[model samples]
Target: MEPLVRLHGITVRYDGRRNGGLVAITDVDLDIYQGEVVGIVGKSGSGKTTLLKVLAGLIRPVKGEVVFNNHKLNGNSFRVGVLFQSPLLLPWRTVIKNILLPIEVLGEDVSKYLSRALELIEKVGLKGFENSYPWELSGGMQQRVALCRALIHRPSLLLLDEPFSSLDAITREEMWMLLQDVISHEGCTTVLVTHDVREAVLLCDRVVVIGGKPGRVRAEVRVDFKRPRDLKLQYTKEFNDYVVMVRGLLGD
Candidate 1:
């Protein structure tokens, strides 16, 4: 199948004045197909986040091109959705109102997306909290609201940057399951940037290991485990082997 998104020869450089001339990433190439999840794993400053920013069109690469469905994205033209480690919800807005912000920003019909907002709230386990403010919810619930906001627009591609990094272990695991369910049902292509090797192995169809100072793809591993995988699968030898392999690629 043709790739839904492609990054070809991507390179990024920052002004030396800002961070003393940091070369964030260079010559990185990747392809993501419809309904597939790709994990980009790297250490701090490995340019994993930079690569994602380039792909999402949040930042322009110093070199190379990003192609989405055969069309070259000029300065982030794709229908992209992003989730950061923090939920980043507006403090004043209610849960439903928070989700509707995108529609308002895009100048789309609020009424048209209203039902979607409500449905996604419920889908992410936030049904009754529509009128609740961000401050009232627990960390996990807040993140659920954030997920709903990202999906409210029904984007073609979703970018996640260590989104569960802030939560406690039990909550993180719950969020992982919730995210997998949402993506599987929505059929949205996703790119997850995470340092958690086990999380990568659990959630991704393929894991792309990034190495070097100016990060590039060091290895790519395909995971053929069955769909709707559970925690028990993590104990299997195949899963452990893949984790060890990825860890090795990361120079662990």
Candidate 2:
């Protein structure tokens, strides 16, 4: 099948105050297929987020091209949903209203997506909290609202930057199941940037590791675990083997 998105020879550089331009990533290439989850795992400065930014159209690469749906990316031409580490929900907006914020920003008719928003609220286990404010919810609940908001637009691609990194260990594990459920049902192509090797192995169809001073694709690991994978799978030797391999790639 043709790739849903492809990054060809991607390179990003930032101007340093004293050290001239710093190259974040060099000649990085990747392809994401429809309805597949791919994870980018790397150290703090390995350009995982930079690669995601390029895919999100939030950053223009210093070199190379990004092709989405077989066409070159052109200034927000494609529909994309992004979730960062922080939920970033508006304090005043109710859960349902917050999910509808994207519709409002896009100048679309809110009534048209009202039903979809409500369904998503239910989908993310926030059915009863639709009218609740962000402050009324727990950290995990707020992130659930953020997840609903990201899917409210029915985006073709979902870009996640460490979306579950902020939660406690138990909550993060719970979120892994929740996220797996959501992605399975929604069937959107996803690109996730995370430092957690176990998270990558647990949730991704493939893992791309970036390393070195000027970050580049150090290794790519294909995960073949079955769907609806249980947390018990995490305790198995097979699962840990993948994690250990990815950790090695990250130089952990």
Q: Residue 118 error for model 2, in Å? A: 0.6
Pairs in steric clash, model 1: 16-21
List of clashing residue pairs for candidate 2: none
Candidate 2: worst-modelled 10 consecutive residues by lDDT: 243-252
Candidate 1 lDDT, tens digit per residue, 91-158?
99999999899889989999999888888988888778899999999999998998888888888899
TM-score for all models, in order of appearance? 0.97, 0.98
TM-score of decoy 1: 0.97
The backbone clash count of each candidate, in order, is 1, 0
> CA shift at 67, candidate 1, in angstroms?
0.8
Give per-residue CA lDDT, model 2, range 1-252, as digits (tens). Answer: 999999999999998999998999999999899999999999999999888899999889989999988899987989899999999999989999999999999999999999999898888888889899999999999999999899899999999999999999999999999999999999999988999999999999999999988999999999999998999999999999999999988885
Q: How much is the lDDT of residue 85 in candidate 2?
A: 98
